[model samples]
Target: MSSNRDDIILNVDKLSKRFGGFAAVTGVDLKVRRGSIHALIGPNGAGKTTCFNLLTKFLQPTSGTIVFDGRDITRLPAAEIAQLGLVRSFQISAVFPRLTVLENVRVAIQRRQRGDSFDFWRSERSLHAYDLEAWERLSEVGLSDYAHVPAGELPYGRKRALEIATTLALDPQMLLLDEPMAGMAHEDVGRISALIRSLSAGRTILMVEHNLSVVAELSDRITVLARGQVLAEGSYDEVSKDPRVIDAYIGVGHG
Candidate 1:
């Protein structure tokens, strides 16, 4: 491990997941570089989502090991991983429907700053202290102007941006994104792509994105999964030219 110490941020060895008689993941291995945008992609049911869950510790792996920041976290819970600065951004459903955009980001900041001791009735003044930081996060994702707008009221793409803003509030060292470009117009896709590139300056991002175009544009490296295992790993151009990869896409419908 020390030989590759300077590069890899996350190391997965022989990872697997099983459900009753079915195996969702089987002997998958991934090495993510520090401060790089790495993508996990495949056709539907390629165990991409299951792998995401396992890495995020939302689901326990049946076998193998996961090491993050030089520590074995194979048995760690989701919350423990979050505390380690490896955080996951949920889909749009994670947003609070009633809370304003500013408020939602503030809540995330509060969680990071105060853990669970944050009191809703703590006093408007104390909460206001977080406003500055919250607004800054919103501004980072181009949502500052919509701070007053209800999170549920924003368009689909902006909601995704808000979700990212809230994730940034935690100041995570590594971000796990599940399909950041899901359900978006071409214009919003460009915006989120730009936002992701901007955020990648100092953060490690591991994402499962179906948009090959965005993946091609944003990823520093790509890991292609097939049938619960590593099928290919390389830059987009390199993987795109592999015949087996082309056959995988052709045999299974593109996700």
Candidate 2:
């Protein structure tokens, strides 16, 4: 909890979403402090994903308000929100498979430099201008050794790192990650956990993740949702001890 409200980077007040007559989310209030790693977790059908969609503008809310950096962005378009520095991930993972790791990151940097307008007439020399920054991003994710390898050939975990590098190229202030460690072995999990922690130094990260271990290890704050509403919010230890949160997971058959 931020003593100074001004330090809160993202706030949602009475946020809700409905599908037909079913309310996927109802009056869910959330606050993420600046430079904190916040985790949103819950059983299936708890509306965590719905909340994510609302934040990213993939789904419009039935009623509520969202404020990013003190600015009301409840109705702003997704692209406009991303342009304002709230870019999402996975959009980067879609990087061209045939492209080498360096080329893939360079493509992302290119997109950051030149919006969506693909000026085919530009010379190759102009594109190389972004290579230096691309290498820096790859280095940040520990991909410098495989710079010339095709992105498609990267190991499962490295592929995830490459995706992260591409996302970092956008230089977003706040990042929204949806299950960043969805499919990975144990070793990869540790590696990515470290990578995510390192990335949190100067930025706020709000993620909806199911891996409780990963969430417990990295999250500075945690919000537990159930039945389309927030059931608990606190530090990982505090939330883990909450009977309601424990029951929600147990009740859902979540191992």
Compared with the true structure, all predictions reach lDDT values of 0.90, 0.90
Q: lDDT of model 1 at residue 186?
A: 92
Off by over 4 Å in 1: 1-3, 91-94
As a whole number from 0 to 100, the lDDT of residue 212 in candidate 2 is 92
Query: What TM-score should be assigned to candidate 2?
Result: 0.97
Cα lDDT tens digits for candidate 1, 41-77: 8888899999999998879999999999888999998
lDDT of 2 by residue, 92-188 (tens): 4546789999999988887777888756578989888999999999989899999999988999999999988888889899989888988889999
Point out the worst 10-residue segment of candidate 2 by lDDT: 87-96
The Cα error of candidate 2 at residue 137, in Å, is 0.5
List all candidate RMSDs to the true structure: 1.8, 1.3
